[model samples]
Each structure stands twice: as C-alpha cells, then as structure tokens.
Target: MSQEVRGVIARGKGAPVEVATIVVPDPGPGEAVVRVQACGVCHTDLHYREGGINDDFPFLLGHEAAGIVEQVGAGVTDVEPGDFVVLNWRAVCGNCRACRRGKPWYCFATHNAAQKMTLTDGTELSPALGIGAFVEKTLVHAGQCTKVDPAARPAAVGLLGCGVMAGLGAAVNTGGVTRGDSVAVIGCGGVGDGAVAGAALAGATTIIAVDTDPRKLEWAKGFGATHTVNARETDPVEAIRELTGGHGADVVIEAVGRPETWQQAFYARDLAGTVVLVGVPTPEMKMPDLPLLDVFGRGGALKSSWYGDCLPSRDFPMLTSLYLQGRLDLDAFVSEEIGLDQVEDAFGKMHHGDVLRSVVIF
Candidate 1:
C-alpha cells in the first residue's frame, strides 16, 4: 500500500521549502522502502532548494540518511527487511562501462526506485540525489541501501552517505595521504574538516586546516587538525609551505571550489604531491591562467574527487564500525537536531556559517 509521509519539498526555484505530505509507493522491482531514522541538512540540500542543482521543482530535499529497511521488491537479496542501512545515491549498475572495466565506483549508470513517490494530487516528485529521505520513509533501489553496523547512531553514521564520506575519501582514497606526510586542506567547512580528520586518521603527521573564519578553524582543531591557518590573516600557500619546511605540504586539498583556492592548493603542495579538488565549483567559474611549463614542472597527479570516489558497500560498513568503536568521531559533525519543518531555517544557519550540520530527525 502507498503510505503518506511528511517530507520537506522545494516547490519551485529559489522559493522557500515547505513541509508536505508525500505519498511513498510500495517497492518496485529491485527496489526497497526504508523507514528513515535521520537525515542530515547538507549544503547540497540547500542547493536543491535554491534550484542550483537543476530546475526540478517540488524536489524531495534530503539525501544523507540512515534507516531500517522495511520492505524489498522482487530479486532483492543484499538487504532484507529490518536491516539497518545508510541510504546512498550511487547504486552501481554492473553493466555500466566503468563497472565493466572493474571500476564499480565509477559506475556510469546508477539506479533508483523504478516507481516515483508522488504528491497527493499524483504529481511526480523528483528525489534529491535519487534518495528523498527527509521524511519518515523513502523508496530507493536495493543497491542504494548499504547495510551498516546498527550500534552506530543513525544521525552520525548516516553522514557517511555524503559530505563526511566525501572528505574522508578525498584524503585517503584520492589524495593518498600516508604516514609522516603533511596534508593541508583549504576551507574548513564540514567537508574540509572531514579531510583534516581523515588525514589524521590515515597517519599523516601534519594536517593543516586553512579557512578565513576563526570559528571554523577552531572547529577544525577538534576534528584532528595538527595546525590551523586563517587564510584571511595570512597567505595560506606561503603558510603551508613554511609549516612544511618551505617545500609546501605533501598533499593539498582544495575544498572551497573557487579558482583562488584551487590555485592555492596547486601552489601549496610539494613537488610530486597530490592535489585533490573535492569542493563543488560553479559552471560559470573559469580557471586562472597557468603556464604550461608549471604544469609540467609540478609533475604530480591532479585529481577531482566525485562523491569522494567512494564505493558505498565497501566504505559504509567500515566507517560504521569505526564510528561504533569510537575511532571515528562522527558525533562531532552534528551541530544541532531539527525537525523536517526546520530545513529553511537550517539553510539560513548554513548561509551564515553557523553550524556544521543541522540534521533532521524523524
């Protein structure tokens, strides 16, 4: 039976979101219905509400979520009813070109619930990231539900579904931080701080957190930063270089997604070091002029991290176990708990740089 659930919806472009009753359909083939426990209020959710993602109106606005699987459709085996799971946007399709080459993380085609959850009037709603979860229940492709340790807090562990995971993976998977290496992260937001923590967790001796905001720098320290540099007060590239004995850091992560910060990351790394761009950039933004000689002289890999280049099935469970063991401090990311109706106000806080994450608990 179709069930009515309360959810936050973006009615139109740049308009305020509202709490509405959405009708969640029964599971279709290769799909599952999850009873959402908690969902994080991320910048991407705000972007969807503001129409920065696309013109898709009446968008279901939450994605970073954890829940219990309630039902599954035909041919489902990986997850059964009552399994605790983190909802992931990327549901790897085995037949995709990337997947065919044995790179499931880069799966060219992902799947979502075949049936759409609709409004009371039968208007189809677009789920943000193909996993609309800012409600009591949500429908998704079975592959989108990655089972994790039930001992972890849903609100905290669910964060691995998005920003936090992206940050961690940027360092460990893409940046390839290693023992005794120095890593400098530009922009000390949740993702940037997560990069710092990931570097520390991966045994990088020096983790430098750079940001314009002093408050965010303080927040970065709690996330395992070995040092903090206020970019407004100092040239971050120079500072990171000086801190790393004048050779720059071994790895520099750009998490601000601006051309200036991208340049900073480029110039703030040691020769043959990695530069990982995990921040989302605007389409209108243009790259600064670069000498062809400098690109050749740098002589290292420059990479962009998409969703942290993570494979949900492999990373989610490992991260959840780490969270359960207190090795990963996922709880620090939650700045506040809110109801679904508070999404708009939470967006205000996000805009003003007030919170790390305001999660909606159902």
Candidate 2:
C-alpha cells in the first residue's frame, strides 16, 4: 500500500516552497522507503526551486538526510527495515566501466528509485538529486541507503550525505592531501570547512582557509584551519605562496565555483601540486583562458570532484565512526534545526550567509 506523507515541494520556478501531501509508494524490487528523521536545506534544493537545475518543476526538495529504513523491497540486501542510514545521491552500479576498474566511486550509472513519487493528485515529482528527503518519509534505491552508527545525531551525521562529504572528499580523496602536506582551501563555507577538517584529519601540517567573509573564515578555524586569508583584503595566490615559504601550498582546493576563484587556485599551488575544484559553477560560466605553457609548466593534475569522489558505502560508515569517536565535529555544521513547514524560511536564511546549515527535523 502507498502512504501519504507531508513533504516540501517547489511547485514552480521562483515560487516559495510549501509543505504538501506526497504519495510515497511501497518499495518495489531493489527499492526502500526511508522515514526521514532529519534533512538539511542545501543550496542545491534552492537551485531546484529557482529553476537553476532544470525545468523540473514541482521538485521534491532536500537530499542531505538521515533516516530509518521503514521497509525494503524484495531482492534488496544492502539495507533492511529498522536500520539507521544516511541517504546519498550516488548509488554505485557495479557493471559500469568505472566500477569495473575498481573505482566504484566514479560509477557512471548511479541508481535512483525506479518508481516515481507523486503528489496526491497523481502529478509526478522530480526528486532533487534523485532523493527527495524534505519529507517525513521517502523512497530510494536500496543502494542509496548507507548504514551508519545509530548513536550519532541525525542532524549532524546526516550532513555527510552531501556538502560535508563533498568537502572532505575533495581534500582527502581528490586532492590527495596527506601528512605534512600544506593545503589551502578557497571559500570558507560549509564545503570549504569540510576540506579544512579533512586536511586536518589527514595530518596536513598547514591548512590555510581563504574567504571574503570574516565570519566564515572564523568558522573554518573551528574546523582545523591553521591560518585564514581574507581574499578581499589580500590576493589569495600570493598569500598562500607566502605562507608556504614562497612555494605555495602542496594542494589548493577551490571551494568557490567562480572562474576568478578557480584562477586563483591554479596559481596558489606549488609546482606539481594538485588543484581540486569542488565548488559548483553555473552552466553559463566558461572556463578562464589559460596559457598552455603555464599548464605544462605546472606539471600537476587539475581535477573536478563529483560529490567529493566519495564511495558512500566505504566513507559513510568510516566517517560516522569518526564522528562517534569525537575526532570529527559534524555537529558544528548544523547552525539550527527547523520544522518542515519552515523550509521556505530556511531558504531565506541560506542567502544571508549567517547559517552554515539549516536542518529539518521530523
């Protein structure tokens, strides 16, 4: 039997989201229904509401979430009823070429629930990032549920479902930050701080955080940044270089998606140092022109991270454990918790740059 639950929905572009009745179907083969405990309001959800992602109007918003598995459909073994899990967008497909090469994190064909979630009137909803979670209960492919420590707080650990995970993976997985390496993260938002925390966890000796906002830079310090650079006051490229003994950092992470910031990241790393782009840019933005000679002279990898290049199955559990052990401060990321009805208000807070994350608690 299908269940009707309250969910946040953006009925059209530029329209304020509202709590509406959504129909959540029973898990079919390879699917599962999750009783969402907490869901974070992400910029991506706002993008969907603003029609920035596509014409997928009537978008079921929210993705970063933690929940309990209400039920599992037949043929599903990855998760079962009563299990505590964090919802993730990327559910790796084993048969993909990337998976075959042992890089399942790069699986080209990620999984989403095959069945459509709909409004009470039977209008189909486009789930944001294939996992609409700003609801009391939601449906997803079984692989999208990654089991984690039940003891962890849903509001905190749920963040690993998206932005937090992306930032950490950008530093540890994509940038290959290591002990003794000097890492400079541009943009001190949630994603940038995640990189700062990741670099700290990886034992990077120096973690420099750069941002235009002083408050965000202070937040980065809480996440383990050793130094903060005010990009508006100083040139980030030169500052990072000076901090690294005139050689720039070993890894420079661009958490701001603008072309101008990316250009700074390019020149803020030492020779052969990696530059990882974790920030998202608009479709209309073009890559800045670069001297081919400079690219050749740098002699290092330039990479764009997709969801922090994370494998949910592997990273979620490990990160959850780290959170439990007190080494990772996931709780610091949650600026406040709101009810589902306040999602529209939360979106407004997102624009003010005052909150790191506004989460919806069931």
Candidate 3:
C-alpha cells in the first residue's frame, strides 16, 4: 500500500518549496524506505528549486540526510530494518569501469531508487540528488544507505551525505593534504571548512582559509586553520604566499566553484602543487582562460573532486567513527535546526551567509 506523508517539493522554477502530501510506495526489489530522522538543508536543494540542475519540476528537495531503515525489499541484504544509516548519492556500482580499475569512488553509474514517489494527485516527483530526504519517509536504493555507529548523533553524521563530505574528501582524498604540508582553502562555507578540518586531521602544519566573509574565515579557524585571509581586504594569492614565508601553499582547494575563485586557487599554490576543485559550478560557467603553458608548467595535479572522490562504504563509517571519538567535530558544522516548514527560510539564511547548515530534525 502507498502511504501518505508530508514532504517538501519545488513545484516550479524559483517557486518557494512547500510541504505537500507525498505518496510513498512500498520498497521494491533492492530498495528500502527510510524513516528520515535528520536532513540538512544543503544549497543544492535551493538550486533544484531555481531550476539550476534540470527542468525536473516538483523536485523533492533534500539530500544531506540520515535515517533508520524501516523496511527493505527483497535482495536488500546489505542493510535491514532497524539499522541506522547515512544516505549518500554515490551508490557505487561495483561493475563500472572505474570500479574495475579499483577506483569505485569514481563509479560511472550510481544508484537511485527505481520507483518514484509522487504527489497525492499522482504527479511524479523527482528526488533531489536521488535521495530526496526532506520528507518524513523516503525511498532509496539499498546501496545508498551506509550503516554507521547507531549511537552517533543523526544531525551530525548525516552531513556526510553531501557538502561536508565533499569538502573533507577534496582535501584528504583528492588533494592528499598530508603531514607538514601547507594547505589553503577558498570559500569558507560548510564545504571549505570541511577541507580545512580535513587538512588539520591529516596533520597539515599550515592551513590558510580564504573567504570574502570575515565570519566564515573565523569559523575556518575553529576547524584548525592556521591563518585566515579575507579576500575582500587583500590579494589572497599574495597573502597566501606571504603567510607561507614567500612560498605558496603546497595544496589549494577551491570550494567556491567560480572561475574567478578557480583562478585564485591556481595561482595560490606552490610550484607543482595540487589544486582541487570541489565547488559545484553552474553548467554554463566556463573555465578562466589560461595560457596552455601555465597548465603544462604547473607540474602537479589539477583535479576536480566528485564527492571528494570518496568511496561511501569506506569513508562514511570511518568518518562517523572519528566523530564518535571526539576527533572530528561534525557538530560544529550545524549552525541551527529547523522544522521542514522552515526550509524555505533556511534558504534565505544560506543566501545571506547567516548559517553554516540549518538541518531539518524529525
């Protein structure tokens, strides 16, 4: 039987999302219904509302989430009812060429629930990032649910579902910010701060956070940034080099996703240093024009981190454990908690940089 529940959806472009009656069906084979406990209001949800992602209207907008498994369909042996799990969009297909090459993190084909949840009027709803989590209950592919420590805080660990994971993975897994390295992160939002934290976790001795907002710069400090550069007040590239004793940072992560910021990241690194682009850019946005020589001259890697090149099964559990050990401060990323009705308002706060993350708590 299909059950009626409340969920937030974007009915049209630039329209304010509303709490509507959603008809969720029973899990089909290889699918599971999750009783959403906590879901973070990520910026991607706002993009879906703005029609930035696609023309798919009535998008079920919420992805960064955690929940308890309420039911699992046949062949869903990886997770079962009563398990606490964090949902991820990257449900890797082990047979993809990327996985065949031993890099499942770059899985070419990810999994999403085959069945569609619909509005009461029978309008098919598109789940945001394939996880549509702003509802009381949601259906997802079994592989999308990764079990974690049940005792962990849902609101905190749930962040691994998106932004936080992207930023942290950009630094550790993609940029390879290891011990004694000097790192710089641009755009100190939830994702940038995650990079700062990841650099710290990996023992980067000098971590510099660059952002237009002084408040965000300060937040970066709490995540173990050794220095903060307000881009509005100074030339960030020059400042980064100055702070590193006339040598640029060993690794620079661009979390802003703008070409201008990418240019800044490109120039702010030491010679042959890595530059990781973790920020999501609009489809129309193009790269800054750089001389072909510059690309060739920069002897190191220039990589784009998709979900920080993370393997959910390998990373979700480990990061959750670190959070449990008090070594990773996931709670610091959550600025406030709001009800589902407040999601629209949270989008406003996010636009004005008022909060790091406003999570929806069930």
Q: What would the C-alpha RMSD of candidate 3 be, to one decimal place?
A: 0.7
Against the hidden true structure, what lDDT does model 2 obtain?
A: 0.94
- Kindly report which residue stretches of model 1 are placed more than 4 angstroms away from their true locations once superposed: none
Residue 47, candidate 1: Cα error in Å is 1.3
RMSD of each: 0.9, 0.8, 0.7
Candidate 2, 186-227: lDDT as tens digits: 998788889999999999999999999999999999999999
Decreasing lDDT order of the candidates: 3, 2, 1
lDDT of 3 by residue, 164-251 (tens): 9999999999999999999999999999999999999999999999999999999999999999999999999999999988878999
All models: lDDT? 0.92, 0.94, 0.95
Q: Any runs in candidate 3 off by more than 4 Å, and if so which?
A: none
